[model samples]
Target: MITEPLEGFLPLFRSWFDTAAMAEKVGVSGSPENLLVELDLGPMVEAELRLLNHTPANAAEAACMLEVVRQNMGDAGRSDGLDLRAVAAVQRWLADQSTNEAEGQPVERLLRRARV
Candidate 1:
């Protein structure tokens, strides 16, 4: 199965980190894993949506996906495998996400830290 869309991808990554101790030794943070994926997904999802001609017909599903992405993005905890450059990209994306004071101070702090 392709899995249940947005949720399972994070776990697969976590499992990889669990086994790949070398990524840990090399200074990587798994904290931003989901956020990294979330950022990358924007274009991919858009393209897929375009191809399928699917306009997110279900409001609840759309809301769920958006919420999950935001939660992941905001979680700036240091895990493993996330480097400075990777975090920098996440920082840029988070900055873009903070439109019209939508994210508040805590999220801002997370964004700053994400810059590593």
Candidate 2:
């Protein structure tokens, strides 16, 4: 099924990380497995969001998606696999999301790290 909705894979990611951390805290034997599907699906979801011109539903979602874009963008001068149009759309949407000073910092920090 399509999990591209704002409430989909992102939340799953958060949950998985949280669960993993808790498991580790309890001295679990191993970390969460990096399933091949999960690894492969990230790029597909990223591409879908970019091509569809997806806008985040809220500040939290924006922040999350911005990270996705940032990772896809990589460090300075590394395009990775993201296209110019997609990057521009992501930038415009992210710019429109910074409604307050507190929220703006994360966006700025992520952008700086991503160099996008």
Candidate 3:
């Protein structure tokens, strides 16, 4: 039955479904949640980096790539796909950058390094 597969997976899917429904109900234009679904996760990672002001040259490149991905997604009329690895990598890099900044290292100097 159609319910068979859902019966097993409903618990896992329920939260996600509820979130989507709530987002729709809120219906705020240009909300981050809406933009998030429209944005490639890779570029979203870069955007997060920008927010943290930890944009290395490589991170800038990644951001540009993500922009292209966003454009392509727009053209294709599809939501941007999420890449968990890219998000994690960017988050880790941001954390490292924050640590370096706290240690009194200039962000510009750290950006030029092989490591964050």
Q: What is the TM-score of each predicted model, taking all chains together?
A: 0.26, 0.34, 0.24
- Candidate 3 pairs with clashing backbones: none
lDDT of 1 by residue, 72-110 (tens): 345562243223223343343454454443354535766
Leading candidate by lDDT:
2
User: What residue pairs clash in candidate 2, if any at all?
Assistant: none
Per-candidate local distance difference test: 0.37, 0.47, 0.39
The number of clashing residue pairs in model 1 is 8
Question: How many angstroms is residue 7 displaced in model 3 relative to the true structure, after the best TM-score fit?
Answer: 48
What lDDT score goes with residue 14 in model 1?
Answer: 40
C-alpha root-mean-square deviation, each candidate: 15.0, 10.4, 15.8
Worst 10 residues of 1 by lDDT: 48-57
Error at 5, model 3, angstroms: 43
What does candidate 3 score on TM?
0.24
Please give the ranking of all candidate structures by TM-score, highest first, separated by commas.
Answer: 2, 1, 3
Clashes of each: 8, 0, 0
Model 2 C-alpha RMSD vs. true structure (Å) is 10.4
